[model samples]
Target: MRNPSSTGAGRLLRATGHSWRGLVDTWRSEAAFRQELLLGAPLLVLVFALDLAPLSRALLLATLGFVLVVELLNTAIEAVVDRVGADWHALSGKAKDAGSAAVTVSLLVHVAVWICVL
Candidate 1:
């Protein structure tokens, strides 16, 4: 899948395309991703609309971004685990559980940060 021919703008374009495809696919397949996005959308507006300090705004933005990033990572982990097989494997369960726990921890941190800032 490595495109040696891609250089400069072509490379950027291809990378962007790959990212776009991932986002679209994640949106379609992951309910948590979609829900987090939808919930964050309004909070995004609130962050900009409020008269908060610069640092507070940044913290708010950072947490929201972090949540999405963690969610995406979790989804990727789940997909890889599922691809390996549907059989009952303890290691697979551990991997998936760990990924879910990561997402939960991220959301908890995000909530804590927002509570402090807002």
Candidate 2:
């Protein structure tokens, strides 16, 4: 068993490692995640390059991050669905669709934020 007193910083570091591993695994397995990172990366730099109010800049950045977060969640849902069974099922389909819709809504929000800011 681990020492309870050392849990604070140690736990945080371990959690960060797990999160990084998840990101790496997602990048490897999910093409959509890779594509979003590819596009979002340069777009993020461009966002900083633009002359805008501080709030607008922050909103734009937050929206971009939100899309990536949604995409990761969608990927996780799809993975879980696949793991449960490879066969087609109505509930599985519904879950996957809902996850996809979440990503779509996030993308729409990103676009809307950009439009409003620019």
Candidate 3:
């Protein structure tokens, strides 16, 4: 969706506001997101403390970021699906499932990367 503001700075400011609202809404409503944060935040701190090669450390960080990004996208997908209607539809289920699979795949890769790095 196009931002209402015409100027670049205005648009950026508006977008940031929208993003902040999204994060707030998601955090308040989504249990899985909160759970992920509980797990990921400490792992993030642990990553910074560990002595590791730069490349490995970066890979670990990237994987954690990837999982959260995918989770956000999945949440967006689920929200859109619900907004469409309450009725059960095959296509909607497929879209939700696909988004969930993306998160699962990201998590698997995250675990693998951490294992390899350790």
Candidate 4:
């Protein structure tokens, strides 16, 4: 018998809900997230429109997903930093800068993948 909080399906459902909430919040609050979505959405459709190998298509899609994941993580970092305090701190600045760098790296990877595949 699965414990109330330990069942695999139950945990998955809860996680899904949490993820949906995060996505909605990010979409509403983050202009960068919205812009990335706008850029990625059309490119994703174009990926489908082009004649590409299965592996190439999968890699292309995965790179786009990586960008979104990185952006979400960056947003989370910024939110936590802001929650901690409004005062300027070196550590806080480092955290936010690191998060931004991660997003930039992800975008670069996405571009590189697309260039290689096409």
The C-alpha stretches of model 3 lying farther than 4 A from their native spots are 1-4
lDDT of 4 by residue, 1-112 (tens): 7588657888899999999999999999999999999999999999999999999999999999999999999999999999999999999999999999999999999999
Q: What is the lDDT of residue 17 in candidate 3?
A: 94
The TM-score between candidate 2 and the true structure equals 0.93
TM-score of each: 0.93, 0.93, 0.91, 0.94
Residues 13-104, candidate 1: write the lDDT tens digits.
Answer: 88999999989999999999999999999999999999999999999999999999999999999999999999989999999999999999
Q: Please, what is the whole-model Cα lDDT of each candidate in the order they appear?
A: 0.93, 0.93, 0.91, 0.96
**Which digits, one per residue and each the tens of the lDDT, describe model 2 over residues 8-114?**
98888888998999999999999999999999999899898999899999999999999999999999999899999999999999999999999999999999889
Candidate 3 lDDT over 1-118, as tens digits, reads 7755756989888889999998888899889888888899999999989998999889989999888888889999999999999999999999999999998999999999999999
Candidate 1 colliding pairs: none
Best by lDDT: 4
| Cα error, candidate 1, residue 46 (Å) | 0.7
Cα TM-score of candidate 4? 0.94
* Candidate 4 local Cα displacement, residue 19, angstroms: 0.6
Could you report the Cα RMSD, in angstroms, for every candidate shown?
Answer: 2.1, 1.6, 2.6, 1.7
Candidate scoring better on lDDT of 2 and 4? 4
Q: Is candidate 1 or candidate 4 better by lDDT?
A: 4
Where is model 1 more than 4 Å wrong at Cα?
1-4
